[model samples]
Target: MAQIVGIGLLVLLLAFFTVFTYYAPHGDKAMGALAAAAIATFLVEALQSFVIGDIFSLGFFQEAGTEAGLLSGVIVAFLVALTMGVNPLNAAIIAVSCGGIGLIPGFFAAYLISFVVKYMERKIPNGLDFIVVVIVIVPITRLIGLLLTPLVDASLLNIGNIIVVATEASPILMGLLLGGIITVVGTSPLSSMALTALLGLTGIPMAVGSLAAFGSAFINSTLFHKLKIGNMKSVLSVAVEPLSKADVVSANPIPIYVTNFVGGGLSGIVIAYSGLVNDAPGTATPTAGLLVLFGYNPAAQVIIYAVIVAVISGVVGYIGSHFFRNYPVRNTDFD
Candidate 1:
């Protein structure tokens, strides 16, 4: 029951944030801000671990690292605040007050604070609004952080563990289901990286999920290119990020989903059956993740299997896409 609730909460939070930041009114600003925060925090965190931590041999950035900890929090707070229309000085102050929290909790805190600030901006009279925000908003949101962070962190970890257990229990079945589901979400407006990281998905599970995403990208690009459904550049760009060609995807979502499902399911089966593993998080381009398979499997075998998966998925996507003739391609600018 706890596991179920934790997983459910994680999914709900992911969906809520994705929709609120991407599809809601004036959401582009929020999305942009979120993107900026993610990039800043994730990049710095990755570099500190992959580079600085390695050199220091102290793991100086492994989530609780002293040197890189507060820096990430301040960056997230500053970007989120500026995006919410706070002045630089106030943004700095608020950021410092929040201190360092983990990414998931930090994001929640940033969103809550921003939401409240935006609301108060409209509701409060101009004469004393800044003073009110500085005096009240910062402390209140920080308190919320104090209350929510531990719960969110523990729940997220539990959710990850639950998924790990389920996958281990029935690797083939869970792989097929999770692989397909994760790929669809990845190709959608939601960020696959964020989802995987949030769930702490790694090893074989990561391999399955990443392959599923790659299958979708390969399928979409191949089918669109073969059919001349959209401009070549636009169609090919789907290989990197499907959302880049949102119009094409929205028009023919069924075919895309079907192809992704078939491709992802098959790849998941292969990963589970062959015992492939990957410790690294997947890249934006799914195929890039196949390289990690080499860590556990032979290089030649990994490459061969990857090619076969891509070819099969592409063929399936191409054939399945023809069933949706009602959805015509819309004109789009490559730039």
Candidate 2:
């Protein structure tokens, strides 16, 4: 029950933020800005967390982490600005104020600060605007963040713990449930990388989640091609990112989602059955996840097993897509 609640809360948060940030009014601009911010954040994080810390075996950046903190503030500010539909100056002010907060809290803080700023813009007099906005708004936003951070962080940690415990308790059942859900979320506009990172899922559970994503991508692409639902290029691109074929996905959402569940469930069973484990993040793709399997199993065995799973998943997805065959395809510009 606790595990269910944890997973449920995580899903609710993801879905809510996704809609709020990407599907609401001004969503296109917000999404574009968010994407840019995500790229900047990923580059900095990879450099600090992976390239320097993991590959170089250096502690220079690790010891002096101030740069990362500053970068995070800038990125969060940019995101807040985008969300608020404000100019750069206002964004910088809010970002500086909201610095040192985690992603979820930062998101809430940005919205709250943006709302207050908008309200003040309408209500407050124009005298001493900089001080009023900067000194007043920034601290209030930061205070809200400071108050919310502990609660949000504690909730996230508890959810992560529940996922870890649930996976350990019954790898197969949890694997199936998580595998299906994660795959669907990955194929959606939301980031699978972000989702996994938020949950702090690792080992067998992570392996199963990654494999499920891989299976769903394979299934989606293969079925798309075989059914002529999309062009070859679009179908192939679905493996890397399903949103590339958003037209097809949106047109046949039920079929695609259901197929993902079936294919992902089967893939999860395979992971549990084989007892495969993946510690690496971003294993939500077949190439990335299967390549990592080389570390734990023989290359030939991994290749063969991956092939078998892909074939099974593809076949299952193909069957599932047939249910929506009669659904009309709507024309939309992917350009």
Candidate 3:
């Protein structure tokens, strides 16, 4: 019962984020901004600090990457605010206030403060609005971020721990669950990148997530092409990055998501046995995820496993398409 509750709470939190992305003002863009920030901060740091710097003993990359990782919250806060329509100056101010906070906390604080800033702009006269924002918004945003950081971090970390424990107990079961859900999320607006980052997942769990998404690129691409859902460009787009064709995928969720789940699960099983570890938190992206895999494991091992994952995903996509071939699908045009 306790385990059930914990799992349920994690699902509920993810659902809330999904709903919020669709309903909240500029939520989708905010999330896109968040993804970009994750790439800029986490991905860069992961590649540079771990792969290049540590491997080559390059101090410059190591220090530079560490600096980027440390500023993740500030970058997330600034970009999210800017994407949500906050002016550049005010966004920077809010971001600076979020310095040293965690990414999720900064995101929430900046997002909520954007509304306040906008309201002040509309209600308060221009001459005084800037003054009010300078005086009122920055500190409040910082305080909120500071207060939320520990709570948010703790909650997400607890969820990660649960997953880790489950994985240790039963690798295949956890692999299937994480692989399928994270891949489905990679196709959805919720974004696997954001999810993994927020969870701060590492080790086998992170490897599962990264490979799952990597395999999903092939799964989605093949599925999209075989289903005749869209033209070549759209097919290629999803192959490179599922989020690029998110609308089409959303429109045809049944086939796309179901196939991704199967493919991702298969890939996850491969990862579970391969023993590849990804210490990077947010490299669950497709291309980046695959590249980062080499950082933690040997080239030959990573290559062999990645090929296995790709073949499994590709086969799953081909087979899944035939199964769902007769199923009704909405055709979409990329142009």
Candidate 4:
């Protein structure tokens, strides 16, 4: 129940951002489109973890049925982003991409465009980065997809087999793993790719981890500004980019270790207290941790408890990093 509701809230927030970016009339159309598209692509990527196994994944369909991936709608949206770069078009493309990989034709299409864009831009008076989507980005995506095809296929079959079994004893433990530790670890320098795996194993904790990871950093930076802790105060005031130089330290295992030790600990305690349960089999990392908290819809009361813990973790993460982090602040007058 908490998982479902949290996802719902996240989706709504994304929708809001998409709409706001789309409706604005300005030079930022490409950026807006990119934002919308990035989120959408992630959403589509998530289907594999949350919905049908690899057998039903877009990559699976593309590998088995044809060389193609993505729906007609996705292709059209991609084209739209190319031509207009409007928020509406990009947002749609993003939504569809995230909805399913079958709808994304991989990056081969992008690869094709890279050359065309580069040549035309050089040949003509003005150049455009618009082609990077298909060329550099999409081609890489396709290559990775092709490479991962076998693993994807085998894993899906395996997941289908194990899900029922995992439902019994896996979720809570997995949830704790994810909520407590993976959250911090995933955000560190080791690998964000790990986060994708975490999300798949258990959508719930991963989702919390997602918002908590970024926002908690913001909150921490904000708090320092409130106090008189040098220029981190000022830099964090704007989220033009969502991190600080402390990212170097923050990326270390120590920070994540400290974070998950407590974050997921809280999540685990709550899982036990609520008695709500998980019914899914999953991979390792955070989502695997979610296995403990499935099936049972956490009632309104339980949801509140989860929220409290999440909030507490976010605050803790912020404060912990804020004070403990050692990074130099940029001087405003240096430039």
Which is the leading candidate under lDDT? 3
In order of appearance, the predictions have TM-scores of: 0.65, 0.69, 0.80, 0.40
Choose 1 or 2, whichever is better by lDDT.
2
Better of 2 and 3 by lDDT: 3
Q: On residues 1-335, what C-alpha lDDT tens digit does candidate 1 reach at each position?
A: 54466447645654565456445544445444554554445434434442344334555354533344345556666666777676666566667657756544554566667766767767877656678877987787677667877786675565556556667678777676666656655554344544565665667787776666667777778767765667778677777656555434534455665566677777767766666665655332364455445555577777776776787677777776666545564443322
lDDT of every predicted structure (CA atoms):
0.60, 0.62, 0.78, 0.37
- In candidate 4, position 60 carries an lDDT of 64
Model 1: worst 10 consecutive residues (lDDT sum): 46-55
* Position 95, candidate 2: lDDT: 79
Question: What root-mean-square deviation over C-alphas does model 3 reach?
Answer: 3.8
At residue 196, what lDDT does model 2 achieve?
A: 64
Q: What does the lDDT come to for candidate 1?
A: 0.60
Q: Which candidate tops TM-score? A: 3
For model 3 the local lDDT of residue 25 reads: 76
Clashes by residue pair, model 2? none
Candidate 2 local lDDT, 35-66, one digit each (tens): 34433453344345433454345687543432
Number of clashing residue pairs, candidate 4: 37
lDDT of candidate 3 over 1-335, digit per residue (tens): 43355456555655566566556777666766665666677667766775678667899998987788788789989998898887787788888888898777888899999988877777887677767777888799989998997887666565566566667678987887788877887886546776687787899989999988889988988888898878888788777777666546655777887788888987887798788999877777788788878878898988998889899999999999999999887653332
What's the distance in Å from true for residue 273, model 1?
A: 1.8
lDDT of 1 at 24: 58
